[model samples]
Target: MKLFHYIVTNRLCHILSTIVIAILISTTCHAAKTKYIWQSSDQFVALEQQDSPSTNTVAPNDHPATVTSETISAMLSSLEIRATDSDKPEPLFTAVAVQSIAPQILQGLRQASPTEDVTFAVIGLHNTSYGFVKSHKVTTGRVYYQAGRLNILIGQAQKEVNDRDDRRLAPFTPGSRHKTSEGDWQLLPQPGQKGFSLQRKDWAAFSTEWQPPAAVQSVSPQQSIPAGLIAPARQPSPADRLIVLKELKEKGLISEEEYRSKRQEILNLL
Candidate 1:
């Protein structure tokens, strides 16, 4: 009888130890997956990180649609200008989108697309000094596409003037324009407005191949398929199906049980 009691007690202790170890592992994983929220900067300073999750929600009017490469090119083709006291309009030197960066969930901001928001690092150049001198005015900023419109928020602007001998004229004048007091979200002005007037320009000369970043490319459903095998009616491979299923589960579009069942179904195809 004593031997039976000892065996039962030993088994119970082992089970309890296993349960505690599993709980610790689960907690560690949850903590590692925590992401930081960042705030937009005016001086283009390093983004401030926040520990809490963002509570921001998108409004109907501000929700962005899925963006394509053409959409980005279209936005970059237009230059924003503001009417000055003189007859000639003053160019705001709006930066053009040169590279696409992965969109992040910003606090008090909405996603720019179905899966994520679209962001771009932009650059603009103009002549700070009159004539065909070597003096150049450069502006850098970030562009966010939302509500079918491009919202540009200039981060920093500086004028670098060089002499006829290619010598430095000034010590890189900073903040050449008037200081902007608007918040990050408030900087987005409607098209044709003073700060956001869209003046069309010939952008074909400046065109470059635009490809989504690697992070965005990985989530594409067609990434694993060969080019020759691509067709409108072609069926997705088991690997492709599994990739999509996992994405849906991560996005919370499917429940845990549904994910497990669908995942098993895709694995069976292999």
Candidate 2:
């Protein structure tokens, strides 16, 4: 009887071990199967409303202009790259963070400084595509630079008038889009602020509140340009244009056919 009992006990232990092993294997496989997605702070699509003129052309103070330009250039140069089995790595600039040090930097440069009460925020927008057969939410990953001011808003108007395809009113207008500022186009609001909430919300008042994240300062090459010099308005070079096109494609601003056609055109120029 003792021998029989011992054998039964040993069998039970084996079965238990097997079950434990199977569970661990299943858990491991489940974990391995999990997919990762990059999420941004906000998402938006282009609106159908007739385009309106932009009103955000406050001549930036020298200091504010310098700091913002440097911040933008550094942000672009730091495009994330992926390693592959080749000499060249592919760039993955899907996520971007723009922090504002305007108030801090400006105080030292100019006598009359921007009010200390003004707060700057970096907003991220995501463009969603429905599927191959149809389009879902049109685009994502739109960045808006908002400055909380006492009286006038600085970045509001220009961001509103631009279309999803980055089309803008002719140059020389009050809010006419400039080429050098093309890099900044995405950082502005989509046309009509469609599907976007521009007003400030009181987060403390609600149980669930959305807050803009801290600017992503991760990548490298912290470079800056002199403030006084106006970035040349010449048409963007091929490489620069490619970057813009890639962004537009990723954002779903341009259809696949449009992207392909424009890409071929740019390549032909090269």
Candidate 3:
């Protein structure tokens, strides 16, 4: 899995700047990082949710199938979506197709479960989109959806700035999983949406059915370690310690006095 360096998200009123003097980690220049995506058919139920069907249950956008949705239309079926902007009552989720992310998605989809309704959401400091050259040398950027079952390219209804990622996953720390108050990762408008605001009680309720971690194997009380094999309490084994002492002395890790002390301990064990 390849990792692309990503930047922090700056608010519009605020500028989310990268680390002091950063580099643009091109995805093609480097391979896409292995990212964990959380998906759910019921994500909308947790939204300010006004009854929305998932991409699988909804009609295909135009006609092509997808795993993720950038625009509302891409994620929803034929239902009338209220425009976040009343001036554009056309649809809330408009599909802004960035063809660059498509081929990779198609390729990943081939590797996922054929029957699963896969959705991928991430909140992290990673590039959500990348640039690619078209046949005619056209430069383009698109949202990259890489997950099991459906590696389809989708995006926010109208966002086209591929170099800039959705602020969605920006705040997530690298190499850690995030849990909402709901205890589920998928309860967002998109995956890892802004301002995780689930109530503490809701998080508790969600965790009620969450099973406790499987019990680690219990060691038998008879599995007592032999005291003779315990060696010295604070040191390594005599044979091993002797080896270390010799190496350290040879490698100049210890003075002669320290070497003598260790050497004597090794003999004392015998």
Candidate 4:
């Protein structure tokens, strides 16, 4: 009977050991699974990857990997799409974060005394001629630099406009869309605002709230003309002089008749 009992106890221990080993094996396999963002092997594939992915039971030694420029651009494009899908009534811009900006552009912006983020702000704009409002809702624009054209974002306009007012001035609650400011501009929130504005003059605010004409830099190289010395002489062209007179008149430097007589006198030279 003692021998029989010993054999049964040994069989029970073996069964328990096998069950524990199987559980550990299953856990190891589960840990080997990778996460979507962890899949850095390819950026485009990573983004366009299964919109819905199953969580793996295990983690790999090294998982979703490095961030490439392609990944950044692709990620930005997705935000743009979200902003587009949601429409608003005021001007909007999407802000993003990066380690550093390109040097040449940074030099120009630094001269403007603009915050570093403006460097990226300069890049995101498709049209250099118009204004962009950073740190706000998407672009279903209320007031666009270009008139008579409608703009929309992946979200609402009033909320964004209000948000611009708040960030440029105060803190706003996340879900509540409407808020007041000195002028009470409507500003909306975009998840995209995360890193776009770390470079602010104020640490308390971290960034100024939205203000119109976020940045406008007009640069023109000037040819120095010595004060006392006359410009070097060249054979004067009648048409060139006429062009100058016309330009001066348009610029209100001279009267229309003055411009006409100047043109006639030059024509007489011909």
Most accurate candidate by lDDT = 1
- For candidate 2, the per-residue lDDT at 5 reads 100
Off by over 4 Å in 1: 1-65, 82-86, 90-125, 157-270
Q: What is the C-alpha lDDT of each candidate?
A: 0.37, 0.33, 0.28, 0.30
Per-residue lDDT of 1-270 in model 1, one digit per residue for the tens?
Answer: 999999999999999988877766765564354232321211111121121235544333243434454434443433343322234433443322122122332321343333232222222344343534323333444343334444444433333323332112111111101234222111212333322432221101111232222312343665576676533664655654664566567667899999999999888876
- List runs of model 2 lying over 4 Å from the truth: 1-232
Q: 15-93, model 2: which lDDT tens digit per residue?
A: 9999877766765663353221221122211111111236534333222222244533333223322222224332122
Question: Candidate 1, after superposition: displacement of residue 74 in Å?
Answer: 2.6
Please name the candidate that would achieve the greatest TM-score relative to the true structure: 1
Number of colliding residue pairs in model 3? 13
Instruction: Tell me which residue pairs clash in candidate 2.
Output: 97-216, 125-141, 125-142, 126-140, 126-141, 127-139, 127-140, 130-136, 143-187
Models ranked on lDDT: 1, 2, 4, 3
- lDDT tens digits, residue span 1-270, model 3: 122222222232233244211323432222133322321110111001111235323222211234332332222321122223243222222121222122333333334332322222221111122423211111111122222111122112222223344323321111111222221112122223232222221111111122222224545688976567544544433554564466567667799999998799779888
Candidate 2 local Cα displacement, residue 203, angstroms: 32
Model 2 has a clash total of 9
Q: Tell me the lDDT of model 4 at 104.
A: 22
Candidate with more favorable, higher TM-score: 1 or 2: 1
